[model samples]
Target: MRWFWKWYLWSEDWKVEGSFPYHLKKMVIIVAPHTHWKDFILGVAVRSAYRFTYVKFLGKQELFKPPFGFIFRWLGGTPVDRRNNNNLVEAVVQKFNDSESLVIALSPEGTRKKVEKLRTGFYHIARQAGVPIMMVGFDFKNHKVIFDEPFMTTENEAADFERITNFYRPIEGKIPEQGLMHF
Candidate 1:
């Protein structure tokens, strides 16, 4: 599968930048400029290309049903119920505490549409889990998947979010207009 994805990325003229930190077995990975479904495909390909087998991503609970459910699970998808009053951050923090190693990826925008500000769940999750946040930029315009140095969350949310916004300012998504509009 890794080789297949490598070939696919090559054929599609896509390339991954930077390296995945192997020392930290557990961390939060946040991908930005998620304006299209193709972002998911690119994410899976990049993970395989980087040989990151422990990476898991959350999908809507609805996606966990039907015949395709098994496929999503095989792809490291974890069912997330977004409708209820679930304490997702605490639950995920508990999961991190229970497991020796776990890398969960989430989109701060929380949707494939333009947003004025990013959701802060990923930041809180990293802080609560005592793990660093891996920021990944999917720059479709450059056909590059860029990875930034892992960042440790601070108590000041405004400043931390400013840093995140600055890092992702240059990256262009598939639907540039529908990408993040502001911090």
Candidate 2:
């Protein structure tokens, strides 16, 4: 499967930038410029190409039901009950604490729609779990997956957010207009 995905992405002319920080046993990966549904496919492609199948993600409960439910699970998705007022951050942190090593990738936009700000869940997850936050930019314009250096969250969230937003401001999403254009 890794070979297949590598060939698939290579055939598509997609490239990855930066080095994967394998030394970090746990991390909260924020894949941004998530302006289209196809971003998920690219993510899986990169994950498979790198043979990083241990990386997991959370999806709505609805996606884990019926005929297609098993597919998400096969892709390392954990169903999340979005309708309920679940303390998701703490739960995810608990998962990280319980496990010796765990890596979860989440979209900062939280949806395919355009947004004024990046979601803080990833930040909180990384901070509370004592894990670094790794930024993955799906630059559709450049046809590459750019990985930024991993950094641990600090006491200054506003300044950290400013740095995060600036890092993504120039990247182009599949839908340029719907990408993170502003902080």
Stretches > 4 Å off in candidate 2: none
- Per-candidate TM vs. native? 0.95, 0.96
Please write out the lDDT profile of model 1 over residues 1-183, one tens digit for every residue. 999999989999997788888888899999989999899889989888778877999877877898789988999999888778699989999999999999999888888879888988889889998999989999999999998999898989889899899988889999999876455
Off by over 4 Å in 1: none
Scored by lDDT, model 2 comes in at 0.90
> Which lDDT value does model 2 have at 182?
62
lDDT scores in order: 0.89, 0.90
Worst 10 contiguous positions by lDDT, candidate 1: 174-183
Candidate 2 TM-score versus the reference: 0.96
